[model samples]
Structure formats: structure tokens, C-alpha cells
Target: MARRSTPAKKKKTAPRGKTKTGKKPPKKPGGFKRLMLGAAMVAGAVSAIIAAASMLELDRAAHKAVNDLAKSSPAPDTSDRTDQPKQSDMDFSKGYDAPNRPGYMVERVPEGENPQNDTETIPEPRVNPAPKVAPLPSPEKGFGAGTELAWQKFATHVPDTGNAPVIAIIIDDAGIDKPRTERAAELPAPITLSFLPYATHLPEQVATARKRGHEIMLHMPMEPTSRVVDPGPHALLTSYDKVAILNEMSWMLDRFTGYVGVNNHMGSKFTADPERMAVVMQVMKARGLMFLDSRTSAKSVGYQEAQKFDVPAIERDVFLDDADDAAKISQMLDRVESVASKRGYAVAIGHPRDLTLEALNKWIPKMQAAGFVFVPATDIIRRNGVKVTG
Candidate 1:
């Protein structure tokens, strides 16, 4: 005890500052409270720091996602754009131009071009057609070489033997003016076209006559009864020797290619002379040609000489177109028809006059319709079976 007295009563620590009512001040915070306060403060500060860090992380992540998306997406391309043609603005001539050129008009369409719309429908061009050609005429029976034997046998069997009446149409004086001869060629029946030896159209007339299916004959001019007659260049006469006659006949034959026989033109004196006729028949027999006596003279020995030479021979039976009148020619045709009907056939010679042609055009058809078989003169002769003389 001693001095411990009143260590100053510990001075009560001035009663640790009192409340206003003098209640002892509450004890200062304990260590645990201090610790809890400190912990709460630290937690609040940490929460604030964590919230700021999270907000910063969210912003950075959003920015990075936006950058990645921008890198992955594709960019738009605008390279080959062009304006299209409207239907009205389309030009058909863009690729092709010349239609008249050879290959341009024949070009094929391009690949992938729309056939219904892009292709054009062009009208076809017009072209002229070719003209028609006339056909050739046909031959009659008993005319050609093949029918010779048959014609001979048939001729012998004909019932009417007396005079052997037959009709022969002769187209005389025809070897000039080719077109005129061609016009005569239109005659339907087998008419004998008498060709002048030296005429300009002799060959053409002969050819056309054959083409027209007519018979051909040399129109030999001989010495006539009257002084007015001038025999043509190759006329046969009694004054000429056998050699001269042969030469003249040869010269005349050379001018034309096809001739079935010969007929006298103004040969009244020459045809009447028997020796001269015999010389002519000998030449004809050697050349395989026939003879026709025009009968200008009643004393003609032409047929008699032909018989002596054993050549195919014939005589003129009628004269057609002696008058230029159509009515008169029609009368002549009617006479021909009557004669042909009475005696199997008859012969009629005519000129190439327009009147004769007109009359023939009218009457030939009528005759044909009336059962008249108009045949070649050679056919008539062969079928008649009269042995041809010179």
C-alpha cells in the first residue's frame, strides 16, 4: 500500500468524457466493430472497382465484335452493268446489212438468239417461171422402115384394086423464107413439102418439115411447055445427057438431107420424054430415092420409067388451093373427101398461101372427123401395093 495510494485514482480517466446527461460515454468501438467497418468499406470499394472493370470489359468486347463482323462480310461488286434494248429500239440490221450479197442472205442465225422474238420474218422474193416448149409430132403407120413388109402385105390384100384411089396433100414451093416454111410445118397431116434445090431456106425447111412430121420431096423443075416457064438451077431436061442428068440429080440431093421422093415443077416437056425419064429413074434407083410424077402433061412417061427401074413411085391425084378463096378450097377438100371415100385415098397438092392454110385449118379437121386417115404420101403408096417403078 504504500505509495500505491491513489495512483491518482486512476483519475477515472476523467470519467472518459461523459454524455451530456452525464451517462458514461458508450464504450468506444470494440476491435470487432472496427474490423467489420473496415471490411464493409473494403467490400464497397472492391464492388465499385469490379463494376467499373466489368463495364470496361463489356465496351471492349462490343468494339471487337463489331470489327470482326466488318472483316467477314463481302463487299458489293458493280462491274458489267449495261442498258438493255427496248422492243421498239431493237435494230435488226445490227449484225447483217446486205441482202443482195450471195452469202449474207444465206447466213445462219447466231447461237442463243431467241428464235421467236429476235429472228425476223422476211418475205420470199418472186421469180419468173420458164416458158413451155411445144412437143414433136408423131409418125403415121406404114411409113418407117420397120413397117415396110407389113405395108407391102397389107397393100396386096386391099379390096379395091382398081386405080387405088388415095389422097395426098403436097405443100409445094417451100424452100425460101424459113419462118414461112415453119408456118407451113404446123399443118397436121403428112403433107409433102417440095423444096427448091438452091433456095436459101432449103435445109431449114427440110428439117422443119421432117420435125413437123411431114414428108419431104425435091421439087425438080424440068423443061416446060410454055416459053414463060424458067426452069430453076437444077432442072432436068431431055437435052441433058445421062451423065448430066445424074450430076444434076446429085447436086439437087446434096442440098437437102431427107427426101422421100421427087415431084416435077413445070416439067411438062421433060416428064413427057421417055428416054429422059428413064435416065432420071436410073439415077433415082441407084440413090434409093422414089419418084412422083406431077402429071403436068398427059403424055408423061415418068411413071412408066419408074416401073421399069422398080423404084417406089406415085402420082399427083388432086390439086388443092388452086383458088385462094376459102369457100373454093373447102370445095376442093370436099372433093378430096369424096374421092378418098370412093377409092381408099386421093392426092391433093397445094401452095403455102395464107388462104390455103386457112382453108386447110378449117377443112382438115372436118375431114379427119369424117373418118379420113390422113397419112404420109409414102405410106399411101406402100399400102396401095402398087409396085413402084423407077
Candidate 2:
């Protein structure tokens, strides 16, 4: 027993973390696990950044597409004038032969200011128009009543002709075609030029025409007999109420200054309505504006209605360029001469067509040499002894 108990063996302790049984204890998580967790966090951050960049690229693509589309097309016109003078207020007056044609714009000038330097572009009536304004607050006020009638105040001065038959060469539908209108204004002095309200550069056009010794009148649009023909923007229609009619009139009258009166433009249907005509005459009388009955319809009550309301009135004796044929226009001029010879005066309406202008250029000087007097439209009204009454 003493020998067996002789050298007691010391327990072998495992290196560092091992058990006495000589098996190593399981390794706790350390640097390798920490490195893996950090790698996972970095990968997540990269994925989020990639997603954000992709979204931004998509947004930029959308914006570029929109900008490209915008660059491809021109903005369409919201309001008035292009040529063709049928029921559509056909801009037959514009001269297509010229370059640098002015775009349609309603340019207005303030009272007592020269329009020669004005560059502001005002808004015009729309193609498919609704009233852009409310009825005038006081339609009757500032319309030139009593002795300060518009017709008398604005009448172009003309030298009296002793015992000569007068002829009024009224150029209708002016100002739409700038080149043609400018050419028309260069014609003989005291020639009456009736302009459409929808034309652009109205103040400048009117001012120039006046300076050249031309009498100005408003070529007011009215309903035509044909439903297919459009009477143009802000035209006076039979369907309009009194307020609507007056509102349209106000818009047109406010376009430019230095005008004697108004005459109908293609108003075959509107001039035929007695009620509508009566409404027109009332405004004329109230405003002291004379009425030139275009006599568009055989059944038109324009003159009679004017008489009833005591509006200084006259009817067209002839139309010089209805057919646009040179021969026809020339023949019509002869007829105008005959009519003037018989009635002591004649009112002939024409346009600024190539043929018409050519015919007029030759005829005017010839007629003047033959003792025929060229006078303003207002002079013809006066020759008939029709005075504006209060």
C-alpha cells in the first residue's frame, strides 16, 4: 500500500481554456464574427444608395421627355385673324405677297398719346369666342351725345366742291392684311377706310390712315344669311340680348380712335331682323354715330330702323368689287358713276384686292380730272341734309 501511494500524480491543466479532461472548451464568438457583421452593414448601405440613384435617373428622364415634347410644337392662336373673307370674317384684306407679315395682336394706345412708338401687344377676340368682359357699367356715358357726336367730331375735313357729284370710295375690311392695308392707306385722300376691330396694330393703322387724309369707320361684323359662314369673333348676332349686343359694340368701339361711324360687314341675316336693327339704331342715335346701311339683304330694315331712331343714315348705292373680276369691278365703277350722276352722290364699297386697287389707281385720277369730287363718307351723309339731332 505504501508503494502504491508513492508519487501522487498532478492534474494536467488544459492550455488556457481547455477542461481537465483535455478537451478544449467551445470558442466564444470574436473578431471573425465582428468582421462579418460589419461587412453585412456595408452591403445594406450600398443597396440603399443604388436604389436612390436609380429613382433619380428615372425622374430626370421624365423631365427631359416633357421638355422635348414642348420644344416640338408651336402654341396655337387663342384669338383673331388669318385671311379669307367669307362668312368667317374672312381676312380678305391681308396682302399675301409681302414678307414679315405681322402676327395678330390687339395693340391699343392711351388717349392723347401717339401710337407710333407703342410696342405693347393687347389681347384680341378668340376664334371660338365667349364675351371676355362684362357689360359696360354705363354704356350711354362717354359715347359722345348732343353736339359732340362721334360722326361730327371725327369727320375728316374736306374742301367743298362747287356743283360736282360726290363719290365715296369706301375700302371695307381693312387692317387685317398689314401690307395691303398700308397700300390702301396710300390711296387718294378723303377716301373712307372701314377697318375690322379684330385686326392687329389698330391704333397705329388708324393713326396712319388718318394722317393720310382718310376717313375711318368701323367695319362691324354681323350675322350672315348662311349658317355655314362664320361672322367672326364678337360679332353681333340676333341671338344676343340687348346687354350682350351693347357689350360687343363697346369692345369694338374701344379698339381705335378717329372714326366717324360704323357700317355692317356681311350682315345679310342680322340686318334683316327689325328688332335687332332697332337695337342698333338706338345705340347709334345715343352715341351720335351715323349709320351706313350696307344693304346686305334685300329685306334689311337697316335704313328704316335708323330713320325710326333718328340716326343719320344712308344706304349703299353700289358695290365696286363684289365679283373680284377686274372687268366686273370696272363695270361696277361705271355704274357707281351713273348712280352718283343721278342722285348727286354715291357710296361704293370695295376691298383691297389686287385687281380692285389696280382699277382704283387708274380710275381715281381720271374721275377727278372729269370734275367728280372725291369726299369722305361723312360728306355724303351731309349732302343728303341728314343732321345729328339731340
Q: How many clashes (backbone N, Cα, C below 3 Å) per candidate?
A: 13, 4
Task: Give, for candidate 2, the lowest lDDT window spanning 10 residues.
Answer: 128-137
Per-residue alpha-carbon lDDT of model 2 for 1-390, expressed as tens digits?
355556888997558855668876777789999899999999999999999999999978856744443333333231332332332334533444322221221112224532222212222422221211111112244553344677877887677665687888888878877777888888865699998887778899999998898989998988776665555677887766555566678788888888888998877767877866777776676676778877666667887777776667766767777666889988989887776665567778888777888889889888888888888877766654444222
For candidate 1, lDDT tens digit of each residue in 255-326?
866777677775776787776677676556545566777666666778777877666677665566545678
Q: Per-candidate RMSD vs. true structure?
A: 48.1, 21.7
Candidate 1's C-alpha runs over 4 A off are: 1-166, 323-327, 385-390
Query: Cα lDDT for residue 326, model 1?
Result: 82
Where does candidate 2 clash, by residue pair? Answer: 84-90, 85-90, 87-230, 94-177
Candidate 2 TM-score over all chains jointly: 0.63
